[model samples]
Target: MKLKNLRYSCRHCNTEVGSIPFASAEEVIRELQRAEEGNGEHFLEYDDNGSMTVRCICEQCEQSLRMNPDYYALRKWIQ
Candidate 1:
C-alpha cells in the first residue's frame, strides 16, 4: 500500500515548510472529519496521489503579523 504524505506550507507566501511520512491517513482523516464545515476546507488540501497539504502561517509571516497588528484586519495582508 502507498503511504500517505503530509505536507505543510505557508498560506501567505505559499512556501513549502515540511512533510511527514505516514503509513496510513486514518487518524488524520478522522480528525479532519470532526472539523467544522469551512474550517477544514480553509486549511486542508488533498492531492490526486492521496497526499495531504496543510496550509499554515510561517515564522516570517507570523512575525510580520505580530509587528503590524493592523494587518490582521485585512483579508490578504501579504500583498
Candidate 2:
C-alpha cells in the first residue's frame, strides 16, 4: 500500500510550508476523522491523485497579514 502524505502550503503565496507522513492509509483516515470531529478550523483538500493538501499561511505572509489585517478578508493577494 502507498503511504499517504499530508502537505501544507501557503494559501496566498502558494509556498510549501510543511508535510506530514502516515505509515498507512488507515492512519491517514483516522487522523482526518479526528480532525473532522474537532472544532478548530482546518483547511483540507483531497486531490485527484489521493493526496491531501492543507492550506495555511507561511511566515512571510503571516507577517504581511499582521501588518495589513485587510488582506485576511481577501481570498488571495493579487500582487
Best model number under TM-score: 1
TM-score for candidate 1, residues paired by index? 0.74
Please give the TM-score that candidate 2 achieves against the real structure. 0.70
Summarize candidate 1's per-residue lDDT along 1-79 as a digit string, tens digits. Answer: 2437877899888989887776555676557646635578888887788677788898999999999999888988777
All candidates: TM-score:
0.74, 0.70
1-79: candidate 2 lDDT, tens digit per residue: 2437777888788899987765545566567657867742467666765567777789999999899999878976757
Question: Pick by lDDT: which candidate is best?
Answer: 1
Instruction: Candidate 2: list runs displaced more than 4 Å.
Output: 1-3, 24-29, 37-42
lDDT of 1 at 21: 73
Model 1: colliding residue pairs? none
